[model samples]
Target: MIGKTFSHYKILEKLGEGGMGVVYLAEDSKLERKVAIKFLPRHFATHSDEWERFKIEAKAAAALNHPNIATIHAIEEVNDEIFIVMEYIDGQELKEKISKGPITIEESIKIAIQITEGLNAAHEKDIVHRDIKSSNIMITEKGKVKIMDFGLAKIRGGVQLTKEQSALGTAAYMSPEQARGEPTDHGADIWAFG
Candidate 1:
């Protein structure tokens, strides 16, 4: 989809793909700025459950306005293709950095602080980010920590999407309650954070 235009955003290149969707770097013609667009995989697009989960992700993230959390610009659909436009973050995943070597204690503290702040904001809004792993955290060139991906987020009082007994987050990072497919609250986030 490189060089293809979707509405006002022109796809520049593929950024990455996750269980939820494929992300692409795009240029917004209207805003004259770069944006990241996430498209639900075609295979999952035809599934109502997956579509609902995708929409929930957009809704959950869009409701938050925090510097440490990647900003959601817009959710759009064109020719039956649904995608979410987000602030283009120029950075590497935390996972990639950790793979290099151990970070300095001071640096780790800073990153942890920023992540906690972001999580606080989400929790204040009653949004529990069930998936909180290194891969979902981005570290910009400026050392800013921005949390990404809310595909498994659970918004309080929101519609139930996942099936019973189905655990939904990265296994390695999931809280015990999450791994067991039990009901979780903000405490679950604390466990994962720890």
Candidate 2:
């Protein structure tokens, strides 16, 4: 369904592909707006757990209303494939922009503040952001920071999170306790904010 049109979203360009899924730039005909559509992996299509996680991600992310978090617009199944629609930012991802040079400390602090506010909002609602990283942070042309990819993050009572020596979050950013396989709370997100 990469080149296919689901409802009014005409697939325009392929933006990204990763272990989780593929992202495409799509046009929202009804609103005359552009949106990002993430398609789940084909292999995981019938996998109950992955499907549950994907649905959970769509529902959970859609519930978050903050200036610093990406807005989830809709989730629908087309031809047995799950796709999530989100605000299609027209600027560079933080990873792409960061390479030009490090952002100023003040700018960096502002980014942290934005993330903290977003995380705090989620945490206040008991939605912990387990995977907060530079790559997951998007920097729009207007200088706003929007966090992405809570696909791996889970609600407290949702799932076991992971299975093995490794933890849920990226190794470079995981809290010590989280890496040690301990249950993490909202403060764990603050610890990762650094």
What lDDT would each prediction earn against the true structure?
0.92, 0.81
lDDT for model 2, on a 0 to 1 scale? 0.81
All candidates' TM-scores? 0.97, 0.90
TM-score of candidate 1 relative to the true fold: 0.97
Model 1 segments beyond 4 Å from truth?
none
**Tens digits of lDDT, candidate 1, 1-194:** 99999999999999999888999999999989999999999988889999999999999999999999999999999877799999899999999999999999999999999999999999999999998989899999999999999878889777776899889888887888889998888888888889
Across 17-123, the per-residue lDDT of candidate 2 in tens digits comes to: 75567989998999999999999998778787777777778877888899888899999888776889999888787878889998899988887788788887788
**In TM-score terms, which candidate is top?**
1
Could you tell me the C-alpha RMSD of candidate 1 in Å? 1.0
Q: Residue 177 of model 2: what lDDT?
A: 83
TM-score of 2: 0.90
What is the alpha-carbon lDDT for the whole of candidate 1? 0.92
